[model samples]
Target: MKKSTRILCNGALATAVIAGLSAFASGYLTGAAPWPASGLTALATANGPVAGAPSVRKTLLGSAPAQARFDRIIVRYQDAAQTRSRPASVLGAVNAAATRAGLTGSRALAGHGASVLDVQHVRRLATGADVLRLSRGLDRGETDRLLAELRADPAVKYAQPDYLKQRLDFVPDDPRFDLQWHYTHPSAGIDAPAAWDTSHGDGVVVAVLDTGYLDHADLNANIVAGYDFIHDPDVGGDGDGRDADAHDPGDWVGGNPSSFHGTHVAGTVAALTNNGVGVAGVAFAAKVQPVRVLGHGGGYTSDIADAIVWASGGHVDGVPDNADPAEVINLSLGGSGSCSQDPVTQEAIDGAVARGVTVVVAAGNDNADAGFFSPASCKGVITVGASGIDGARSWFSNYGATVAVTAPGGNATSGSDPDDRWIWSLGNAGTQAPLPSPEGDRLMGMIGTSMASPHVAGVVALMQAAATEAGRPPLTPAQVKALLRGTVKPFTVVPPASKPQGPGIVDAAAAVHAATQEIPVDQGELLSNRVAIAGQTGAAGDARLFKIVVPAGMRSLNLRSYGGSGDVSIYIAYERVATPTLFDRKSAKPGTGEAVVITQPAAGTYYLSVVGESAFSGVSVLGVYQ
Candidate 1:
């Protein structure tokens, strides 16, 4: 077995009455506010007591309905109206729509000032749409009615609610090598050691769309230039709107210092490693681009959408172009709502994916179905859930079919021994500012689906780096997500009967190893007849590609692999080589009895691959078509 190179380590913006909002914010501050911590009883610091706090499980675990109210609406006018019409005329058209909806008339918003109107323009979006803030917040029904009326206008292209998104975070406790068990634990860990031998994500850039970065010795070296996208000064807490500085001035809404949430998150993605320093990060050698979107309270949907596009190297109207485009974008924040309810945010995610960026998001900390969360439920993104030391779904992790995979997000509530269950990463000791001694306050232990999302993001960086090092083109977002789901480690503990937490916990080593292997076109065997071909895969991550040409007018095509001693999976695709990540159909049942049947099959060459989910021998592959 390959050995690890370095020392071990472990470790919404939105509103609505988010159950754990206060606890999440104050719990992670300088001292213990309310959340649980290590075995140590309350340890007092300059700020206050910082340990042995009571668990907010009841408050944190329950699902809170997303705020079903909106104070703004986004609209995109038809081409001529948006580009050619006078500002007054556009305002008139919008007011006309508002009148139809039984709302008051409105005025055009100034270039850099506020306005008094029932529906006043807020700003333009990166996608060329316009945002208009209402005089007051509207209930769900009222917002829906307003949107309908706006969309009914002849000059309107589309109209959507401008919802708010909150960070999907929770406060964790304790910091030490033992507490970092999520990195190397036999059953619960991600197996980062084996992956480190192959790739430390040296050349990849991962964009963290969360609170801005706080300077920390362990993470500063791995952080690249980032941008602050928060436009509301009240939320920014930086006394200004959007600017070039991504420095976190603190996001404390109360008497405590900031939570240093982004710093903790960034550390997990790419903190400096093997430097005889604090804690090790998942993709320690990768560069983290901090894209600040969430701040005090949370952030607006429009700012987040713009950040998503800009982080992936797309153009945002006012922001400068990203010099370092991210291969992976981690969204550790979200709001309570279905993806369909927020088309603007979904559109941004869609655009980012189309640009070939692997978007990873938290399934949410709500124990309910992940499909209820924005971005988590959005299409073309890898939604992740949290797992615990026992290898079961974390108590607070959102579950459902939408979750792509699980990772160690820690469960401090597991039994009484909660000391080693939380994830330890870089953090700050100062409540509102950096301490004089950087190293003293550089470590933090935290848990949440927020933490879980970054683990997958880091793994993606490693995979992309490994593939590039192997001389392969970068994997597309779909391909990356496919590999992650296909290579997950099966859960050791059975999850709740109804809530499915994806295939299993993420296996970093398995994912990276798979990313490094590619099948050559010339190596594929051609199936000339219906005779069963016997083959074997030497070990897990090994695969055998095959090609079969189906004649025109084929009514059906069937393929199967059976009689294997160990586990194997079958993947089939038309006209292209099939791998786990790039397959049209796949069957990965236990052992090796797998089959794929296609009705009204397309007339073309079919590619089939038998992959070893574990070492397998004496596997027989047969294909039949009529």
Candidate 2:
């Protein structure tokens, strides 16, 4: 079946607007080393069955002030077991049950759980259950009614509308950089107007988890407070407002500041901008909370888990409610390993999400398939990959089903000139200037998707701001994700064709503008990516590629635009010439946004007409892989 295509914000909107956390590229046009030699090749065109199915169970709400309580409340529920309706009706049934018990909403919160319930509207307000806010419209007694019903319904599992949530990262938009290319991707470095028409996300917080950040002039203002999760317990911080850990402050030096990756990532999210010095970050302004988890070399998964819990209001044994709790957690580090559904990793990530904090992760830089990365492959979290200057794959960014989207990480390390590199961010001011000599200043432009993830986190902040400006309605995680995806400026050419697959480069202007589009708009879906003779019109946006799952025995096909205004003359041939192929030509009158469809006469590996038209939109669909 043909699907409607979704268009997002044009690059015009990203002209420097003020807002919160933001984050989000690729390579050149050579031969298709990663893609098929022919322009149209087959790939796993359709989305496979979703892998993980994590459930959302809420007891306490996040916005309930640091004092509300509850044991558990199911976000989504049904009454299959009870053979009846859900919690609402269950409440009525339970009230009947409660009346039988001679009590109204007879129940009590279990332990110290009352201190953690809030988050009434969760669309983009909360990630999971950390901040559980009961429906404000519902009365206290209504809880009793539902409880009575839930406890009675044998079929009813649970029922709770997901609360809204807003998550982001720390970044600095210093405007000063050795080089900066605002390639429309927020992750490449947030771009928009200097001020907002309205303040959408004023009261939200984001936790940056990466290298320990250095104290820089650009970042001093955005920080709320943070902690060091680096392994060495001996390495305590200066305890002063600064995150100077007990360890000696030095460059990657004698091998030290590797831990500061956290700090760098933080700067990219909420770095103080317009100060006339360094670079500016995606989120023009956002409250950043630093949570250091990697240090001196690398860190163990255990410390990272604890850090996640602490970032949220959840207690870690005795580490009081973190000095700064986060509404969103930024995880820009990940290993090139398969996602092991291990309890620990899963729990930690799940716990963070449970608390209404959106978790954003990096897709890794191994240049391998996405299935090879953890956390990125983890279910629910926003997994982002890196692209380059020209909006091409970074040659090294991992790709696959798990990847949600691509951003400009800038391929500083990938051999592409300025064309491929990361969004410019901030470097730290050495604690004690380099003894004024050989050391010089430690801060320098670093590269990697590691550098790009925070940009998206910052974008999330902007989205939150957009919602706030619209009034504090529930902004669910699903909705936030949808907005992010739908807002993307679809790339006509695949990411510079470095990696095998790419969601295409991100466009911050497109993303923020995407927020302005209708809520339920379709983001467009692909049926397949395989082609036989694969080809594109010698022109720019022309040529159509497709995937056709060949049923059985079939070959030779005739295809044409389904709903064309008039008889169009397009071509059907092979690409790299030299051999027999199909679908390669120009068109006389492709018709104005005419509906096009290419079908196989029978079914087999083949390619069809390549009508040179501009743009990847129009109902006209392409097919292959058959």
Candidate 3:
């Protein structure tokens, strides 16, 4: 995030709420101020203690709806008056302290500035090295001990976990899926390419932002059209507009620290293979467009916001717009927060949602709750949290009511979910000679939801592919989200597990079939939110996508996955990038299960793409608004 934060929500202006109340009672009484626990509730944080979910038979949706009420405690180097001149010393200091204090995770670097080496915004102390955003930990003893330690340390400027806040809604796991993936890969469930020959994400064009693509034999044909977004960072590359794709090293060499993420993300969405060697993507036929935004010192918030608009086929002053519109946009990066909305962040997301595009975002690696990040907490876009193949929340994933559906985004101990981990994909050699004969082929092994997100995107492409071929209008982002949400299956993970929700594992076979279908909500189906609720109740292949009819008089809908106890917490959905946004939205009821509010111009048929909280079951009710 840039230092000049604006146009989004609140706490985003400056990541500076971390220095409050680490002092003692006397210290608090003297110089410290009172905490606004009540107001803070507006921006809530985590609830399951730390690094886990609640223990229950059915996972409940939304984190009790209270995480949004907490005040956000942001922390950053005061010296960072401007993002450009943030100062490296501050980042160095923070990293030194973090390492000394024993905070383990990705090591920090002087990527953003000088005086401000690095900054971290957290929802709970469950993760991070130095700074944190902790609300009152239910355990008084634990809270007190942590407070004492923070105050005792001189380097620790100040601490306050209970006062500030932020809000994270529904989000999810991987990228859009590949089209042809359903074929060959049994997980996708399709027996052969012919099974999907009638349709696949062929009509869908997905843009992959990263280093220059290899233009390999299998991949060359699938690429619809692309441009180089990478302007080259000093650390690597010829800084050329489109250097002939060459030998890129590391799962990330040549590609700036920023570009590497894009490549990793691409493989997850569309790697190639059916003809022979390597892994298969969710939607192999979907077009892959590469956009390079993260080239140097991370990227500026402005560039990303622009990318969002561009990715959706919106015009950008200088950059070439994504000629073809995408139904979904995926984001896997963010700054800290305690559930507080950043105006700057919101605007960008709002702009995207305003269009018909559905945005998919990462819930965060904070491993605490969805109330931890900025844009992911936005109300509209789909906010995704990571999970293990075992159906448990990844130890590194942030869970809360905001989370939509969970996908296999490898964990801290492992990488992508075992089912998809080390899965082969086309290689991205930054800029080196081709394979076997300088112009040959090879594969790359990578991880992270950055890698997983494309899988989801690929699925979206196939859904679009089916819609196009079947003589139906292409689905809006909302419709796609609804389809994917209600289709997820339940997988279980017990204690000693790092993730809160186990894999719940995605079923590509199921999703591909669902994509081939076009559930038409005719005139008769319109005006009411009552779809043989009982008969319409069954999660398809995605686990996250479910089917429900809008009941009459019910304007709003609420789907919760309630866990029986604290020892075991299942999730329904991970987060929502924004509000009232989706691939499709029929008449929905006013939330709170009270009254119903209809949004469709007139009473008509509508379908909700199911977004899971943890592992939902039981009365997944849809209310109609009056």
Candidate 4:
């Protein structure tokens, strides 16, 4: 059946841009070992599922706050201060800028931590940048003028207001978060809450190209105007052909009811989250554009192709230009046949990729090779397979080389306890048409590869949004696919299917953090041998790496990391990076602190790595040698 590819609805699964938190909040990715030759590996962990701890829920509404005032500014000079006594040249430039901006009482204080400034030294960065504080917070205009004056000085390389940073380790107040084991499970889940600390997919838009969306309070707020691309009136189910209205009229046929498949998928990608309502979406702050292509007896390849182009900002002959074009497109619907045999669909995917849109598609549910599916077999698109709560490939998901990654798509076997294994999201109760009353709004648990595709799409949106918030350019389609394939979480068990299920499960926190550019490590800063640096890492399964060199005369070396919330494991490797699975010296305890000492240590480069057993913060990595 070419119809939206028969997703099992009976209790089965399916499927941030802000001033991002510091790069360390999610941890920076260092060059690491490549995926195993077989491509996919099972995650070998001793941890079990986490029990739910539902908290008091609250919602925030109203317009956003006004522009912020600044009382501190970080100024970097062309030269470093060799001595602690504030350099005379640096003092003169600061005084000059203060005077030019009509400010008084400017003097350089001792460099350290936070302190009020008439004009004073805050602290010196490893790169020799100076943090300066003002007497009081200045309004936007005054701060701008002050920055301009500071930048005008020949000695000043750069100057900008020091923005206050909030903790990025956010836990949403959504009541349903407790029910979402697919997000909270330490070994099997995606670790989305910790990633939320970095970004909320703020400005990115994801187009859900499938059956049209239905009206539901949980999803309506994040939805934008989308076009109906069902060319045939019979297929559309509506009285007319393609139109701007993307509302689902239902696609019931005899005994089967309307799947409301697209609504569920869109909800997974981006439902109104943290609203103290029903469920939370992966990229809740992102907008979902509903481009209806599947309907009645299923949609034509031609219709799906045109919808892809238009949603990605390309123009169709009679369709209007998409104003809020999507940065990501989720096709939770697919058909049989190789991509080469479907030239139009392949061409459309190519065009979308050229336009810089990341295309994500389902790897079908035929329990066969994904290489035989249309969009999944198509090049330039991310083919997503389905996995259950156990982190194994879902029983019905398509597999093989073409599948890029697996996501939580739920599994409801006939006699097994599938209640906890289903993917939960927004849905409607109407069997064949739009249900009347708010009572029609529903929350459902479904299982299928159709459900898994949106999970990857949501992660892509988070990656793009985090990149933008971090002041980095959006990743190209190729880069997005690579990032996803590179940052996946290993399945807990190998798939029993004959073929492999691509790389592994998609990890939201890992992928989002990896999307940000890593800050270059400076070996020069570690010459003192006795230094402590503050660092952080996202949810369990996320990791950070640090490199240090030992001098020849050192008698002993101590490496310690302490004072962090949440559990973490530390690993030490000689001359190379270490991971949870590959490390020389290791500490895999339950606490936040880990210590390892080396007596008569060899003189060479050493790698210290911290792998999170859970989200951690305020950790101090100390290195000392005597």
Q: Which has the greatest TM-score?
A: 1
Q: How far is 183's C-alpha from truth in model 2 (Å)?
A: 6.1
For candidate 1, give the lDDT. 0.74
What lDDT is obtained when candidate 2 is compared to the true structure?
Answer: 0.45
**TM-score for each candidate, following the candidate numbering:** 0.76, 0.51, 0.51, 0.56
Expressed as tens digits, the lDDT of each residue in 1-626 for candidate 3 is 11211111112212211100010000000111221221000110112111232221211112221222222232232223324112253344434444454332333223212222234432111111123322222133333333444445454434333321111111111111122222233332223243244445675667654433555554666655555433224412445533323223222223211123444455456555353423455566676666544332222233344456666776654455556766666665554553232433454555666676767666665556454565556646566655544445555566654555666554424211232322234543222332342243333333344444555666666667777776777676656666666665554553243233322434444555666676654212121333323212111111223323433454445432222211111122112211223332232222212122334323333333333222222323343333
For residues 414-437, write the lDDT of model 2, one tens digit per residue: 222242244545443332221222
lDDT of each: 0.74, 0.45, 0.40, 0.66
Q: In lDDT terms, which candidate is top? A: 1
lDDT per residue as tens, model 1, 534-570: 8553333346778898888888888999885767789
Regions of model 1 farther than 4 Å from truth: 1-65, 78-90, 105-117, 154-157, 173-177, 255-257, 414-417, 433-440, 519-626
In model 1, where is the ten-residue run with the lowest total lDDT?
12-21
Whose TM-score is higher: candidate 3's or candidate 4's? 4
Give one clash count per candidate, in the order shown: 13, 144, 213, 12
Q: Work out how many backbone clashes candidate 3 has.
A: 213
Error of 2 at 152 (Å): 36
